[model samples]
Structures are given as structure tokens and as C-alpha cells.
Target: MISRISALIAAVACAATLAVSPLVAHAQDQQASAASAAPAEQTAAPVAEAAAPAAAAATEKKDNPYSLGNIIAHGNTVDQAVLVILAIMSMGSWYILFIRLWDTAKLNKEAKEVRASFFKKASLQEGLKSLSETGAFRYIAQTGVDASEHHEGALTENIDHNTWVTMNIDRAVGEVNSRLQGGLGFLATVGSTSPFIGLFGTVWGILQALTQIGVAGQASIDKVAGPVGAALIMTAIGLAVAVPAVLGYNWLVNRNKAVMSQVRAFAADLHGVLMGNRKVAGR
Candidate 1:
């Protein structure tokens, strides 16, 4: 009975060891899997973080073309003088553009109405009266009519017909052209100067950046980007101001030229009409 009991107890202990061995093997396998997975997860975490910044940066880049905010972010690099010049150019250009546009439209409309009325009736007095109601074109129209009327009367004052006609036509054209060209000189000046002003600002900024780079003892993208970027803003802003002004200046100049041409033509036609009327009345 004692021998049987000893064998049975040994068998029970062997069974317990066998069961614990599988558990230890499973735990080792789990720990190894965890160790291997931890590096992948750690690597993946950094990749995800890196990708987030790239996506965000791409999104930001897509939103703005000029990215004025970026230029402003590095504001300290820009000179105050450059900023002031840019502001003045921008405001001045826009103001001239709007004012000149309005003037051109108004002049064209009034000239059209006057041309239609004058051609329809051929009454100089009626045309002048109709023109005066509009307030602006009356100056041009009245100058033409008054000069023609004066010359018509001067024909009786022993003045030569051709000389009197030529002199009054010259006076009328001069006055009309002068009024048409008013304030246009300033627009041209501003358009021509704005780009150079912006260039000066850019050069100033670059000089400042170089000076800083010399002091920093290292010339890297980080050190050079701010001042260079700020300098470029001035150049861009200058162009922004100059391009429209130049375009507007040219456009207004052409429009005024056209209107003035029409006025001169009208003056010539009026001179002929008046001369014909005087000769007809005399006959």
C-alpha cells in the first residue's frame, strides 16, 4: 500500500509540472509578440505625427496665393519705410483708378448725348443749352459754340474768314484738351514711380538680411528666410500697386484722347455749319 501511494504522488506532481510548462511557454510567446509589436507601434506613432504636419502645411499652402499672413508673420524683418511707401502707393493707385474710371464714363456718356442732339437739330443754341444741364461736358461744348459764334460775328468786323475760323478752332481745341488732361499727369507719375519705390524697399530688406546673416555667424535658410521673405513682400506689393495704376493710366489716357478727338471733330463740324449759315444768310 505504501509503494502504490508513493508512485501515485509522483505521477500527480509530474502532471502539475506539465500543465505549468504550457502556461510558461504561452506567456513567453505573448511577451515576444508584445516586444516586436511595440517597436512597430512606436515607429507608426512617429510617422503619423510627421504626416499630420505635412498635411496641415499643404492645406495652409493651398488656401492663400500671396499668403500675406506668412509675410506678416515675419514682420520684424521688413523696414517701416517700405511699409509706408507700399501703403501710399496702394491707396493712391486705387483712388486714381476709381476716380478716373468714373470721369471717363461720365465724359463719354455726355459727349454721346451732345453729339446726338447736335447732329439731330443742328441748332447751336439748343445744343449748348442741353449740354449745360449735365454740368461737366458743358465746358467743352460751350467753348466750341462760343468760339464759333464769336468768329461768326467777327466776320462782320472785317476779319478774314479763314483766319478767324482757324484762330477760334485753335482756342477751342486747346481749352478742351486741357480740361480732358487734367489730373492725368499725376496718375502717370504715380504709376511710373511705384515699382521703383517697391524695389528700393526690397533692396533695403535684402541689405538688412545680409547684415544680420553676417552677425549670426551662419548663413542658413532659417536665418536668411525672414528678411528675404519680408523684402519680397515689398516687391510684390509694389507690383500690386503699380500694375493696376499703369493699366488704368494707359486706359484713361486713351479714353481721354478719344474723347478729345471727338470734341475736335465736333468743333470742325460746328465751324463748317456756322460758316455755311452765315454765307446762306448773306446770300
Candidate 2:
């Protein structure tokens, strides 16, 4: 009878174990499913975040109102004309500045060559040969030589040899001075007028803004700011064009003065030699 009771208890315990096994397996399956789903959710989150910046960039591009496109598109005929004029002025000033600067540098280089090679020669004839054939110094020297050689005719009877040579040297120096001074006037004009031109644009823009305000019956920031700002851009552009021109003009002028001073000193010494007032080393 005890063995039959023990067998009955063992059978009841086995039945209870069999009933709980499926619940534990289901819980484990759910946990595994959740673990697999978490990785997919994390991967999808990064993709959504990456797309957000691209969307914002596109929106910002569409909403940008102060771009060059807007300035050109919304501007009227006069405003566009003013912009064109300022552009032209800026272009012209820069072109003149660069060209003049190149010329000045070349002249300065030539002056140095003249100083180093010209005075070392023993005689005027040898000195002439030492200078570059096409140089300004050579031209001045040749002119003096020719005047000295050719000053014995009826045409030159009134002027003495010394005066005749002096006159010719002066003329040659004047020619070089004119060449060095080229394009400077344009720079001055641009510098002096660009600001006023820009101010005109600003004034025109303000007038238009006032008209708009009168028509719309409102002085709101949106209405007032856009036109005023665009107009102010013209003034800024004008100033930008003007400042460089002024600075360049002054700089070129000073460089020209320095170059001319060297040339004049050379001329003076050359004159002394031509008139027999001073002697070269070999002579």
C-alpha cells in the first residue's frame, strides 16, 4: 500500500512539471524576439536622423531672401543700372591700378639698370652703348648728342649750343613724365565720384521705400528693411570701389615722384657732361 501511494505522488509531480514547461519556453521566445527587434529599431533611428539635416538645408535655401538672386530679381530698372555702373567703375579702376603698377615697377627696374651701368662707362659714346637701346635714358642721351651734332644751321642760330641741348633734354623729360602719369586721372575721377554715385543709388532706393510705405499704409520692418538694405548695398559697393582707387592713385603718384626724381638727377648730370661743364672718367 505505501509503494502505491509513493507512485501516485510521483505521477502528480510529473504532471505539474509538464504544465509549467511551455510558459517558460514562451517567455524565452518573447525575450529573444525583443532582442532582435531592438537592433532594427536602433539602425532605423540613425537613418531618420541623417535625413533631417538634408531637409533643413533644402528649406533654408528656399527661404533665403537676401541672396544675389533676390537683389537682381526684385530690383527695378534704375537700381539695376546703378549696380551696373558701380560694377563698371570697379572694373575700370582695378584695371587702371594694375596696369599703372606694372608700368611703375618696370620703370623703377630700368632706373636701377641705368644708374648701375650708365655712369661706369668712360665716355658718353660708351655710356650710350651700355644702356638698353629702347630705354628712356638712351633716348635722352641720343637726343642730347643729336642736338649737339646738329646745332650749326640757320634754324638754330638764335639758340646757343648749351641752350639748344637743354631745351631738347627738357622736352624728353617731359615726355617721360607724361607717360608715367598716364591713367592717374581716371583713378582720381573714380575715387572722387564713386561715393556720390553710390549715395545716389541709396537715395533712389530710399525714395522707393518711402513710396512703398505710403502705398502700403504701413511702416513695418519687413517692408522698410528689404529696400533699405538693398539700397545700402549700393553705397557699400560704391565705397568698396572708391577706396582702392584712391589708395592706388596716391600710391602710384608717390612712386612716379620717386622714379622721376631719379630720372631728373640723371638728366642734370647728363646736361653737365654735354655742356663740357663736367667731365666723365675717360674724357
Candidate 3:
């Protein structure tokens, strides 16, 4: 009976060990699967982090409607007209600036040529020949010569030779000054008024924005700020248009003064030449 009981206990212990081995193997398999999944999760976390910011940026760009392209595309008729006027004013201002700058440069170049070539000649007739046909210097020289030669004319018979020639030469210088002053008024107008034009656009935009916001009854920051902010861009653009025009106007005015001074000096020298056989100052 004791031997039979010992055999039965051995059989039960073997069955328990067999059941426990499968559970241990299953636990180890699960632990290995978890370890592999952890590495994959670590790699995926960095990729997800990078993708999140990119997705956010795309959403922001999609939501925002204040880009220049959008302003032009989605703008109302008044907004479009204001933009057009500002554009035209800006373009016209630059065009006038460039053209006036070119004119100033030509005047300066002619002044130099007069000093080098016209003043070096021995006689007034030879000096006149040295100047350009269309140049300010030649015009002055011809006016003085014509006045000296035609002293008997009804317009100038009462005036003496010296006085008549001087008057003609001075008038020529004044004409040159008038020519130099051309287009400067436009620049002044643009500079003084462009900011107001832009402000007009901004104010109109604000009015529209407010009207819409009032009708919608959505006074929240997101709703109010976006349209108002977009409206302010018109003011910025107006200022941008105005600043260069103002600066260019000032610069051209100063340069014009310098040019006119040189012209007056040349006129004085020419007057002396007509009256006497005086040597030109620079030569």
C-alpha cells in the first residue's frame, strides 16, 4: 500500500511541472514581444513629433488669409480701386524720380563740358560753337550774342548794350532753372498725400470689417483681429509709397540748387565776356 501511494504522488508532481513549464514559456514569449514593440514605439515617437509641427504649420498657413495674394484676390471693389491707385501713384513717383535724376545728371555733365570746352575758346563765337546745340550753356550764349547784335530792336533799344545782354543772359538762366524744377511738384504731391491714400484704404477696410463683425455679432479676438490687422497693411503700403517719394524729392531739390548755382556762375562769366575781352575764370 505504501509503494502504491509513492507512485501516485510522483505522477501528480510530473503533471504540475508540465503545466507550470508552458506558463513560464508563455510569459517569456510575451516579454520578448514587449521588448521588440518598445523599440518600435521609441522610433515612432520622434517621427510623430516631427510630423506634428509640420501639420500645425500647414494648418496655420491654411487658416491665415492676410497674405498679399489673398488681399488682392479676396478684396472688395473699393479695396481693389485703392490698391490700384496706390500702385499707380507708386509707379508714377518712381518713374518721375528716375527721369528727374537723369535730367540733373545731364545738366551737371553739360556744366562740366562748358567749363572744359566753352570757356577755353578764344572768342565768344568760338566758345558758342564748342557748346552743344541743345545745351543750356549754348542757349545762354546765343541769347547774349543775339541781344548784343540786335541792340536796335524795339524791345531793347531803350536798354544799353551791357544791360540788354545781361538781361537776356539772366533770363536764360531763369529758364534753365524752371526746366530743372519740372516733375518735382509731382514728387512732393505723392510724398505728402500717399500716406493719406493708404490710410483711406485702411479706414475703408476697417469700416467693412466692423460692418461684417456687427452683422455677425462675433466680437471675439480671433474674429475682430484678423480683418482689422489685414486692413492695416494698406496703411503700411501707403507709407512705403510715400517715403521714397519724399526722400527723392528732397534729394533732387538739393541737387537742383547746386546745378542752378553752376548755371548762374556760367551766366555771369558769359556776361563779362560779352562786355569785355575777359579771361574765363576756370581756364
Candidate 4:
């Protein structure tokens, strides 16, 4: 009887153990799934965060208020006209600067050639031939020669050969100088006036801005900043146009002085040759 009672207790305990084991295994599986999903959730969070900045950048690009397009679009007719005038002035200044630079370079090159070959020639005719036909030195030499040869003309008879030759040489030098100085005035004008023109634009822009502010009855940064910035851009443009023009003008003027010195020296030597003081050949 004791053995049968023991056997019945063992069977009941085994059934209970079998039922609890399955529940414990299911709980373990659920915990394992949750642990694996947590890492994936954390990794996905960083990806979402990185994408947000790119979206914001796109939004900012679309709303840029200070771009040139916005300036032109919001500007008045007079403001646009001022910009146009500034552009035209800038264009003219650059054109003159480049053209003058090219002319100066050409003249300097011709001057060098004259120094190297002209004085080495056997006679005045040979020297003239050696020089570039379009050169200022050749022109001055020809003028002096003509004055010496044509001293008998009624218009020139009152002047002695020396005075006549000097006058002709001086006149020729003046002509060359005038040609070299052709665009300098325009450059000066642009440099002096561009800033004022820009200031005019600024004034006009500010007046308009003020008018709008008065109408809007508000002084917020958003309302005042855009127009004010656009107006200031005119001043900046003017200065941009002026500074280069001024610099180019000064540079060209200095270079002109150097080139003219060479020219005057050539004219003086030619004058001496015409006066029979300096022989063309070494003999």
C-alpha cells in the first residue's frame, strides 16, 4: 500500500513539471525577440535624424531672400534704372581700360624698336624707314624733316628753321599725346561719378523703403532688411565700378608719363638732327 501511494504522487508531480516547462520556454522566446528588435529600433533612429537636416537645407534654399533675383524683383523702376546705369558705366570703364592698356603696350613696343634700330641707321631716311610706319617717333621725325625742307613757305617764312622745326616737332608730339590721352577723361569721369550714382540709387531705394515702412506701419527686421540690403548693394556696385576705374586710370596715367618721356626724348634728338647739330651717321 505504501508503494502505490508513492507512485501516484510521482505521476502528479511529473504532469505539473511538463505544463510549467512550456510556459517558461515561451517567455524566453518573447524576451529574445524583444532584445533583437531594440537594436534595430536604435539604428533606425539615427537614419531618421540624418535625413532631417537635408530636408531643412532644401527648405532654406527655396526661401533665400537676398538673392539677386529677389533684389531685381522687388526693386522699383528707378532702382532698376540705377543698376542699369551702373552697369553701363562699369562696362565703359572696363572697355576704356583694356583699350588704353592695349594702346600703351603697342606704343611702348614701338618705342623699344625705335631705340634699338632707328639711331643705328646711316641717315634720317634710313632711320625713318627702320621705324614702324604707324609709330609716333616716325611721325615726329617726318614732321621735323618736312619743317626743315619747307621753311620757304609763306606761312613758315617768318619762323627761322630752328623755330619752325621746333614748332612742328612740338605739334607732332601734341598729336601723339592727344591720341594716348583719348580715354582718360572718361575713366576719370566714371571713377568720380560712379559712387555718387550708386549713392543716388541707395537714396532712392531708402526712400522707397521708408515709404513702405510708413504704409506698413511696422519696423520689423524682416520688412526693413531686404530693401535696405538691396539699396546698399547699389553703393557696393558703384564702388566696385569706381575702384577698378580709378586704379586703371592711375596706372595708365603713370604708364603714359613714362611713354611720353621716351617720345619727347626722340623728338629732341630728331630736332637736333634737323638743326644740323647731330649727324645721322657716326661720321
Question: What's the CA error at residue 109 for candidate 3, in Å?
Answer: 1.7
Please write out the lDDT profile of model 2 over residues 1-283, one tens digit for every residue.
Answer: 9999999999999998999899999999999999999999999999989999988987784733544456788778887888898889889989988987887787788889888888788878999998878778888888877886678778787887778989999899999889878889989999999999999989988998898899899998777777788788888988999999999999999999998898888888888878773333227
> On a 0 to 100 scale, what is the lDDT of residue 277 in model 4?
41
Which is better, 3 or 4, measured by TM-score? Answer: 4
Per-model CA lDDT versus the true structure: 0.73, 0.85, 0.86, 0.86
Candidate 3 worst ten-residue window by lDDT:
274-283
What is candidate 1's TM-score against the reference? 0.64
Q: What's every prediction's RMSD, in angstroms?
A: 7.0, 5.4, 7.1, 5.4
> Which digits, one per residue and each the tens of the lDDT, describe model 1 over residues 1-283?
9999999999999999999999999999999999999999999999999999999988784533234565554355445656676777678767767876776677678778767786677576766677756445565456545554565454455777655665666676686577667667767777788788888878887987798899998898777776777678778888888787778878878888887777767767767776776788789
TM-score of each: 0.64, 0.76, 0.73, 0.75
Clashing pairs in 4: none
Model 1, position 104: C-alpha lDDT score: 68
lDDT of 4 by residue, 8-74 (tens): 9999999999999999999999999999999999999999999999889877857456555776786
Task: Please provide, for model 3 over 1-283, each residue's C-alpha lDDT reduced to its tens digit, 9 standing for 90 to 100.
Answer: 9999999999999999999999999999999999999999999999999999999987784734776666788877877887898899899899988988888899899999988888788778898888889988889889988886778868668787778888888899899888888888988999999899999988887887788789889877756665676679889999999999999999999999999899999999888877774233325
